[model samples]
Structures are given as structure tokens and as C-alpha cells.
Target: MNLEAIRAIYKFEMNRTFRTPLQSIIAPVISTSLYFVVFGAAIGSRITEIEGVSYGAFIVPGLIMMMILTQSVSNGSFGIYFPKFTGTIYELLSAPVSYFEVVLGYVGAAATKSMILGILVLLTAGFFVPLRIEHPVFMALFLVLTALTFSLVGFIIGILAKGMEQLQTVPLLVIMPLTFLGGTFYSINVLPEIWQTISLANPVLYLVSGFRWSFYGISDVDVSVSLVMIGIFLAACIGVVGWIFRTGYRLKS
Candidate 1:
């Protein structure tokens, strides 16, 4: 609500992120490089082209989504968690800043980190395989929306979390499993009819499918459906997080 306060918190979080370049920057780059080597090169070689694209190239969108999802989640979660751990959160709660400002600050920085890593991984993928951008605008839109959605989810986890362990729980326990099962490396079309139907239940599958569509002008799933799912997820995250802040779910005793 307060634009100045939101901007101030946003700038503060961005500066804090820069101070620790390793967590915000280096780690994602390293992890993405390893993924490009192992999954994109090693395993990709064993499999031939899928949907008329090389296996390495085909997985690029998935890898980018994976990096963006993890970075946004981790950054936003920790951004709130550390402030609470250090007692700065009490100051924030007492400040004139609204809950929207707090989330916008932390979530914006987290999304920026995800975008940076997404671009980096895209570049890295190019080194291994020829890269193409079939729909640049849609690709950018999906990336931003996915980043914002996960950032909000991370903010909720951060607010609800009581300790550092809880901060790691969501991504490790939930996001990871969902991503692997989301048709990241392989399309659901290759699976049995039942498994294919099950894969459709996964939200991450829609994200991966939509992103792949941007790259190759083709996808196993409908792009509009993916966009709609992401929209719903984003709305749900924002609504729940807003409720948590208003009710002081975990922030106030």
C-alpha cells in the first residue's frame, strides 16, 4: 500500500542479497552447470531426439524452470526467516509497512535471482546444444509469472516456518518431488495412459510444457491451459499469503 516503504524494503533485500553473492548467485550457477553436464549431456546422449528436438535441447526449459523454482523459493523463504531469527522482523511488524510491502520486497528480489539464473542456464544450454527461441515474449512472460508464483509460496513458507528446518522442508519435500514427476526429462506421452493422466495433475508439468512451447512452438500440453494453471496458482498463493499476514498466523503470538 505504501509505495515508499515497499521500495525501501525491496532495495534493502536486494542489497542484502548482493552482500552474499554465493547463495544468491554462485550456487544456482554451479548446480545448473552440473545439471547441464549430467542430465543434458550424459543421459541426453543415451536418448535420441524427442518431438523432433535433441534431448539436450528439449530439456532446456525444464532445467530453467527447475533453477528458477528453487532459487525463488529458497531466497524468499530465507529472506523472511532470517529477519525473524535475527529479531528484525519485530521492527518490520511494528513499522508502517504493510504485509504487501514486506512480501513485495522479498519476493521481488527472489524473482530477480530466478530470472538471472534462468538466463544463465539458457546460455549454458546453448554451449551444449543449439538454442532457439520460438516465442520470446511468451517465454519471458512464463518465466516472470512462475518466478512470482514461487516467490509468494516461499514467502508463505517463510512466515509460517518456526525454524530453519521448516524453511527447507517445502522445497526439499514438496517442490522436488513435484518437479521430478512433472514430465521434466521425458514427456508424459511416452508413459502409459494411466500415468499420462496422472502426470496431468502435476502443476509443474504445465509450467514445463508452456515453457517448452515457447522454445519450439510445440508442446505436449496446451499452452493456454498451462497459462491458466499458473494464473490460478499465483492467485492462490497471493490469497493465502495475504490471509496469513492479516491473521498473523505465525508472525504474532
Candidate 2:
């Protein structure tokens, strides 16, 4: 795409996010803070160390992962949904912008928002616990990759959704359950051997484990496996999203 087209799409997507400052910023930060308080402060004191890190510290990566995944998904879902709802997407669809350009613009902005929220939550957690990063580069990589993966998922859902209600349902019913079951609050090692094997099926577990590895220099699952899983998820989402947009799946109808 030309620079002009790229600029237009980027600005449009960014403006949509900034338009609702509270929903985009304060809401996720506050909700995550509450998790830090309830789980990190209240429960952490009673639980002691988890895998050599303080319970409070152990949950920090999980909390950040949670915020990134949710916000990225929400941002991406809404980015496309609002235009479709307001009858403005026809302008976008007919414009000079390619589907690839459109995807990059929306996904880029969503990733930015996710990273911002991730950093904000990490900072907030620092106030309550002594936060440390075992691998800064790996931590950053996990954050970006996970955000992109979820943003693509959100894009698919946004295109499929018929109304505002459907937008909320996907995250509430699907994403939330996966996150909670994904070793967000505790280590998978704490589970029964059978349960541990089953929790391995959760996609979120790989994300959380990769993020945790970045924090404590250790992981319940191999960092390589987590990275591979994330890579595969990203690749799958990209392929599916490209197919959806290429066919104009729900967007054109």
C-alpha cells in the first residue's frame, strides 16, 4: 500500500480506540489492579512461593498476559464491528485499501493497546509486589506475539458477529474460561498428574507458561514448546484471517 493509504487506515483505527478513553484504558487497568489486589495481595500472603518466586510475583506475568489477550481481542473486535454497525464499512471496503492493509491497520493498533495495557498492569503490580523480569527480550516477544494472535482471533469474531451482543459473548464465554483455566492463578504442577496433562490442552497455558518463563527463568512447560505453540497459533490465525478477508466472509454480506 502507498504511504497515504497506510496513514489513513492507521489514523482511522487509532482514532476509534482513542475515542473511548475510559473503555480503552482505565477499564482494563482498574480491573487488572483488582486482580492483583485480590489474588496477589490477599491470597498471595497465604500461599507462599510458587516455583521459587513469591506467589505475588508468580502471578504477575499471568495477569499481564490476561490483560493483553483480552484488550487485544476487544480492540480488534470493536475496530471492525463499529464500522459494520454504522454502515461505514462500505467506504472502507470500496476504498483503495487492500484487505491486507486493513488487517495490518486494525491489528497494529490493537497490539499497541494491548502492549500499553500490559505495561500498565505490570507497573501496577509492581506497586504491590517486587516485580522482576528474568528475560526482558523474551517477555517482550511473548507479549507481542500473544497480542497479535488474539487480535487475529478478534478480527475473525468481529467479522462473524451480527450484533453488539455477539461481540461481548465471544470474550465472556470463550476467552474468559480459557484464561482462568490456563494457569493464570496457580501453577499447573499443582494439579493432579491427570489434570496437568489435560491443562496442557489449553492454549492459554502455553502463553502463560512462556510469559512465566520470562519472569522467573523457569517454566512448567519448556519455553521452546511454548514459543512453538505461539508461533503456530499466530500462523494459523494469519492464514485464516487472510482467507476470511480475501473472500469477504461476513464483512461484505
Candidate 3:
């Protein structure tokens, strides 16, 4: 394996983030803070508690999950897309690097950034409301898996995208909505019977549910189920990425 190649790519991506701390780090923290302000003030006043946790605290895991998911995708997609957009990807392809090495660099950096943001957001949330982690081990597992899985999804997106519009569209149009609808602001159990059934079909629900369960020991589904759902999705994303590299789907063109 080309450890140097992976290290080079990883350092480049991480350096980019450090160079633009305002956009990469501060912006996300601020955006998440706004969610707490708007949701905590507007909704928390009325709802009070959900499953014995204060509304403000209850939403912490969801908010962190949302941030992790969106940022992972955005970072991974842009890390690769910029290379393609600038026509530098061919240079990368010509380099002494394997496809898996290339992926490790971009996806690893993205996941690292997302985890930082997730932890920072969690800390910031602690300032607003009481917090606890009944299952710290599982919480860490969910965080790492969610970041890596979504980062892979973003890698695939970056390769497939033809332009900036397409690169930005999927996260805005698809991922954001799914996160919101996936037990973020409210639990799916509160929904009507049919809506609950429909909500179960959303993959993001499992991510949020499992993370929330780790925090408060409550979730819409079993923790094992959440683990299974995430594992399946992670495997599927890995398979898709492997296929993309094997065929050179959009990268070769």
C-alpha cells in the first residue's frame, strides 16, 4: 500500500479545511447553533419533554447526527469534485496511487472533519441543556460509522456529478430532507400509525434513533436493529464505491 500517497491526499484535504476554518468549522457550528435556538425556543417551550429527556437535550443527538451526515457528504463530495472540476483528477489518476488509497484519503479526511464537528456540536449542546450518555461505547460506534458511511456516499456523488449544480443538489435536495424527516426534531413514534410505518422506511431514522438511544436509553427501534440497518447501508455504500472504482464509471471519462 502507498502510505505516502494516502498521507499526501489526507494532508492536502485536511490542510484545505484548516486554511478555511470559518467555512469548514465555524460555519457548521453556527448553523447547528441556530437549529438549537430556533427549535429549543420555539418547540422546547411547548413540548417540554420526550421520553423523560428535556426537549432541548433530546434533540442533541439528532442535531449532531444531522450535522455529521450533511458535512460528511459535503466534504467528501467537494474534496474529489474540485479535483475533477479543475481537470486535476487525471493527474491524480496518473499518480502512483491505488483507487482504495485515493478513497481512504478523501473519505478519511471528511469523516474526521465530521466527527470533529459532531463532537463540537455535542459540547455546544451541553451548554444549552442537560446531557448524558447511557451507552458511550455505542454512541461512538454510531458516530464513526455514520460519518464513514455518508462520506463514502459523498465520494460516489463526487465522481458521478457533471457540474457544481449536481454536486450541491443531492445533499440539499435529498439528504437534508431525509435527516429532518428522520426523527430529528421529533420522534417517529409521535406520528400516526401509517406515518410511523412510513418513517421506518427512512434510513436516516435508524442513525438518529440509535444515536439518541445511546444518549437517553430510548429510541423508536431496538439498538440492534439500528446497528443492523447502519451495517447494511455501510456495506452497500462500500460495494457501490468498489464498483465505481472497478469500472471507472465517471472518473475515466
Highest-lDDT candidate: 3
Candidate 1 backbone overlaps, count: 0
Instruction: Report the Cα RMSD per candidate.
Output: 1.3, 1.1, 0.9
User: Candidate 2: worst 10 consecutive residues by lDDT?
Assistant: 1-10
Q: Residue 116 in candidate 3 has what lDDT?
A: 97
Ranking by TM-score: 3, 2, 1
lDDT of 2 by residue, 192-240 (tens): 9999999999999999999999988868799999999999999999999
Candidate 1 stretches with Cα past 4 Å from truth are: none
**Clash list (residue pairs), candidate 1:** none
Residue-wise C-alpha lDDT for candidate 3, range 1-253, written one tens digit per residue:
9999999999999999999999999999999988987788677978868979889888899999999999999999999999999988887999999899999999999999999999999998888888999999999999999999999999889988999999999999999999999999998988999999999999999999999999999999999999999999999999999999899888885
Evaluation by lDDT, superior candidate among 1 and 3: 3
TM-score of each: 0.96, 0.97, 0.98
RMSD score of candidate 2 (Å): 1.1
Ranking of all candidate structures by their lDDT, best first: 3, 2, 1
Candidate 1 lDDT score at position 50 = 91
Residue 67's lDDT within candidate 3 is 98
